[model samples]
Target: MQNNFIFFFYLLAFLLYIPTLILGTFLKPPTKKQISPPTPQSILARIKKGSKYTKQALEDFEKLFLNAQSCDQTLWLEIIKEFALSPSLEIKEITSLQEKLKQNNPNLQNEIALTISVAIKERK
Candidate 1:
């Protein structure tokens, strides 16, 4: 009787431990992968490919603004101008770009606003 009781106790512990291990394997949260931001050259390449102005492009452009302090001012200005003047962009899309510019770099807002206005006029 004593042997039987000990065996059943060990059996119960084993059963519980197995379920705990399985649950732990399944319930563990996934690790997030870190993705690097797009570079100016990459964005320019995308533009050169004649891809339409898109939300993803705008997001990548914003990333450039976030790193603007480390980038060449003149180069970024030219890139912004070129991006704003994209033939594929509609007036509304230009407006969205303007908003993004303002949000990312207020110092350049006025210049970009002017560029966006000119681009809108040219589109009309």
Candidate 2:
């Protein structure tokens, strides 16, 4: 009876172990998928894609600038809007660029100076 009990326990252990051994033998380990980084062209394309939205915002700003009754406040508003909507640049960098443009080109028109600053910053 004790021998029979031991046989039953061994049989149960074998039943559990055999399937796992068979599966381990038959199944391949999972491989890591290699993800390629974006090429410069692809990165540029994505930046361009996002720029469409920026362009639309700029167009709206242009319309607002054209129609504004108060140029002083409106120019500031447009500058703020441009900085706000600019793609992915750090705020401090944009601010510094704007300040440098303003200091260097004090005689330039506000809109033109802002346009130059934004163009320079966004390309980075």
lDDT of each: 0.70, 0.54
**Top model by lDDT, which number?**
1
lDDT of 2 at 96: 61
For model 1 the local lDDT of residue 83 reads 72
Q: Model 1, range 1-124, lDDT digits (tens) per residue?
A: 9999999999999999999999998897888999887777667666666746444665777765643465776766666666776777666777776787678777877777787677566656
Go through the candidates in order and give the clash count of each.
Answer: 0, 0
Q: List TM-scores for all candidates, in order.
A: 0.54, 0.33
| Cα RMSDs, all models | 5.3, 13.9
Q: Give per-residue CA lDDT, model 2, range 1-124, as digits (tens).
A: 9999999999999999999999999999999999764332333344346655444444443344333232454454445445444665455655664565456445544764566456655546
Stretches of candidate 2 off by over 4 Å are 27-39, 49-124
Residue 39 local lDDT, model 1: 71
